[model samples]
Target: MKFRRKKSGYAVIEILLAAAVFVTIGTSIVYLLIDSGYSNLQGRDRVLAANFAQSGLEATRNIRDSGFDKLTIGNHGLALQNGSWAFSGESDIDQSGRFSRQIQISAISADRLLVTSNVNRIAGISRPLNITFSTYLNNWNKTTLLPPSWNTPQIVGIGSTGETTGNRNPFGIFVLGNYAYLVADQPSSTGSEFFIFDISNPQTPTLTGKVLTGKRVYSVFVSGNYAFLTTQAQGSTRPELVVVDISNPATPTIVSRTSFNGNNYAKDIVVVGNYAYITTLNSNSREFIIVNVTDPVHPVTTPVGSLELGSNVNALNINGNYAYLATANDSGEIRIINISNPAVPTLVKTYNNPGLADATEVLFSNDKLFLSTLTNSGTNPNFVILSLNPSDLSIAVIGQTQLAGNINGIALDEAGNQVFTATSLSSQEFVLLDITNQAAPVIKSSLNLIGAAVAINYNGSYAFMAVNDLIQQLFIIGQGQ
Candidate 1:
């Protein structure tokens, strides 16, 4: 104690520095809170505006329910007339005076009317927000066949069913008319893993209904009144194939679920007729499972057989008696399965090349087969076009070209002349490749995105993409974009 060193200024300096750091961190946290508060306020209003637009549409529906003549072609406002909903002025302002709503009606035919509802945030708000909902109304009593298909939006990812931020991300999407069914990649504690949306408009999709299913869903295929989901088994009790009844898009319920014998991840699914073909991640165990879905309510049968592909199958496409699987095998990139016998599926052939290895998506259109693959840094073919002989199912590569990054998904127009792809590139993830001339393909158009585009759907005029971003999970890519 007597030999203790003199007090050093360094200790005091260190204490002062520590105090400064604490102050800085506290100040940063305070600023972040303030900024987030403002952001949430704007976000909450957008949700409200979406609800407002939906209300306007439903009100029109109510009017239609009363009488078809009420849906006259014109821009009309909504009001309560004689205790019944009716069209009024050009636009209606909310009581809060924060939003304005307008309805536009047009005749598609004598029995059908295209109804659009538009909502916008009024003045006084720092940021402007607008929402739109469009749907085709039909005189159901007068129709004999199924209702005509609905309008396809240019860009749609997520929209209003009062959706909130949660531990979820977009994984699968299927569009039916103005409706889009979305499946998330993670389980929601709130039990909303499956979601349905109204995509009659762009950018802002409308949420209609949602339900809970698997702990992790990889892909979704909608056929008839059922939504077939490829989900990962959380445990022995959890299932790999979960089927939900979406007869009423507003309310979906899980009717049946099936689990495989081995531990695996169910990746992609494609429903054809009475069979639901699902692929799993690469392993010794079954990588391809075929379940008889004739009875969607009770889909799985005892001893449901599966095939081992030995390689990872990222995606699958069905054509007639064949199932094309895009795989990541060194010896074979595309595995053609003869599904003529669903219970006993056999591998027909495997296609692979020097530069093309990890195949991600396979698309069949006309007499052509398109493959989107992950590429290397240099010249590695990623977009491949092949000529297929449907009779014999022979494959011959017509041409291929190197792309910047891994191609996540591909969709073709009705004409099959243009090809659309979502890539993993941070920028230019959405690309349009001209395959009009199969011998040579060139990039026609591309839209820069901040994150990777995971999945995509196209209806000639519009491309609905499910991106990897939480804030903008789904969006529209107009033909013009």
Candidate 2:
């Protein structure tokens, strides 16, 4: 017991062996942790690559949906322009710059295309990491337009009238699909300012629904499931832009109203995608207003500042990224404002009416402005065509026509060879003219109405007219010989 003698060589060797085993276990754990971390990183990279590849394919599909002509046979990157997808560059990189994506479009047929999306790691730890997807796209854009018809116009149906007061004057008329929406100044018997009619049967446009939007609804522009309207401001703080949900033709609901504080009231409105460009009767203050209607329920105003037009704006039309304004300015009856940069709208050009008359209604087609002016010299070219010079953005009046009464509303056929306009005259208020020869357009047909046709629209086959008459507020015109 006293002699804890010198340990055996085997015991010393056993101790060293135990230490070696512990060291080996510790080293194994360290390597395991490192490998686990690298595995997680690789998994994350693969997920991101897959997501990027999927996005590339989706964007290509969007381009095809918009216009198949854009999908050419080449590798392309994507750029979002005016809330639309467009091809740009050769390849696109991820936000972190760690990955690159390319969309390859190949022509499969005249109406069909092959899209191949490829994504790969371009930076950081890369030992061959790639993701790919492919899809076929078809032109689905084969649209058969409404056939051309210059037949005599007929008042096929009469719907929407006031049950209480004398008359609810119709201010705006829009025909979309099988429905025609009319916004009026005075509320009808149902205390409604918005009326919806079923035009599937143009012969008998049945009054389908009505929404009471107070009074003095001045203008309306329908898009998809909603109708954008401009109303006379009830109070200085009252919103002038009203959004109505017409998802249900039998029952329309007023979802939202936006006020950009443009002027006394919103005079006209034009919606392009998610934004709504509005003008007011403010000659002294900011008249051009922009509203972000992306969220149709809760619209945000002044997102892209406002512009002072220096004149009372009567009507507004947006084509591409430009906004055409019909103003009361004697010198600048037509104001062409560039809206490509929505944040700051600049006046590109202005045109004076032939008789220096104020513009009442305006439309643009093929770089030409189809305009109607206020009362000038009796029958002194109230309606004129203003041509635009692309290089310098200059304006020129090429052709003109006149009516006994002021032309209040205008419409154009699909081919752009025919134009339909309504006047304040009690008789021959609806007139159609052939514009094949731009220098001098000839009237094709004219129809007499019960009262002054204040608002009018054409849909290839039939012409719709909204008159100021009390008995027949809506006159559905049909094609006749």
Candidate 3:
């Protein structure tokens, strides 16, 4: 009778354990459901935020396309009033309760506008999530398109002194006295590497001599009676500086070849006094090497006197006691070296800016440092002008203008107040800019060449361009008043 009574009901401890387990499982399920809901809401907010941000950008662009005067500096909200896009001082979208958008317009130049759009999501949260987008919008509708006669760029003549071998890759060009030396890449079977053109007749250029260097020549600089060239390495041979005696334009001969310690690939060379400053890329390192070329027959490298730039030095220009080196990297940099004492050069100053991305060429003239850069988003691909203080080597940006393509070379005409740019993009091979007012550079004329313009040099009234098109590889552009 006692056993029957005990089994009729469960123990108190068993009931307590069962209750605890049930409570634990119920709590976990509730928490997980709450977390999942929160995550879904956050994602939804992000999607809305992005959509609203993009909408804001489209509204700004629409306003710009309609009229540049519609956009003004400061914060503004886009709205549709009376079935038309209108900007309001308040930044709240009537349809989007949790979202707010604003746009800011800044004038970069008289014709350029820097437009920025921002969207914020405040869904009853302490911290609001925000998204932003920005771009430069030029007033293309208002842009004045000048005719070719405004800049007066006339084609004087065409010459192909080194195109007989079927390789029309004309790279570096140097005009000295009555002769123009052009360094071109030839097929391995051709043997000839560089060509000399008789330019005494500016209208007609005749190939007078061709020399074989057994290597790919990239640049050539003439000094006195010698032509210094920088060549690309062939096979296991390291690149070297080849000195050619051009005393007679009809027959030029290589007198000496100077090699460096590392596997150097010379990109450019500038001769100052008795030294030859070369911008080279050795292995992965970049530097400017100094070689003593006092005696053209036997050149000697300086004793650890190379200036290491730590970036790819694309172009170099020596002005007075300073050398301006334009290094092209993710963030373009201009390194100024104090070559006051050429033997032991020191880094004097370095300048960098967002507009200087991929600086391909540099020219110092009229107390200004002009730099040409590759095409990059959010940047004007044209050349940037900076004021240079010769006393202390200080630099300040004057302004920037837009060019059509990637500028590879820049030839400054200080006396003529013009800047010639050689570009590599199709349809924008050669460009002429009038720098009469350094603060505001306007495009004078542009020539659309069939080939890519690789290099440009200005002498007197003519600009010699090294082109790599299928038909014409060399062009002489006459700049007329």
TM-score of each: 0.67, 0.66, 0.66
CA lDDT scores, all candidates in order: 0.78, 0.80, 0.77
lDDT rank order: 2, 1, 3
TM-score of 2: 0.66
Off by over 4 Å in 1: 1-166, 202-204, 414-416
lDDT of 3 by residue, 327-424 (tens): 87555478888887777888888877576467778888878899888775565545789998877878898977766568888898878778888997
lDDT of 1: 0.78
Higher-TM-score candidate among 1 and 3? 1
**lDDT by residue (tens digit), candidate 1, 1-481:** 4787867788999999999999999999999998777766776777678788989988999999999987888998888888989998999988888999999999888988889999999964578888887766888778565432222213324442233544456777776777777777663455566778777776567777887773767888999888888886733677888888888877888898877666778899998887888888866777887888889888765435578888888899999888899998877888889888777889988888556458889988788888888864467688888888878878898988778888888888737567888888776888888777878888876776646887888866567777775444666776430
Residue-pair clashes per candidate = 6, 0, 0
- For residue 442, model 1's alpha carbon misses the true position, in angstroms, by 0.9
**Which residue pairs of candidate 1 clash?**
155-476, 156-475, 156-476, 157-474, 159-205, 161-207
Per-residue alpha-carbon lDDT of model 2 for 1-481, expressed as tens digits? Answer: 5977786998999999999999999999999998767765765676688778878988888888777788889999988899988888999998999999999988877777879899989897746788876767777776343443455455666675433353467888888889998888764445788889998887668888988866688888898889999998734478888899999989999999776654567878888898988888874678888878998889885547578878889998898878999998888888888888888888888877767677888898888889987667855688887788777877777788887777888887739588888888666888887888888887888877757888888887777888885435788776642
What are the root-mean-square deviations of the candidates from the true structure over C-alphas?
9.8, 27.0, 19.8
Worst 10 residues of 2 by lDDT: 143-152
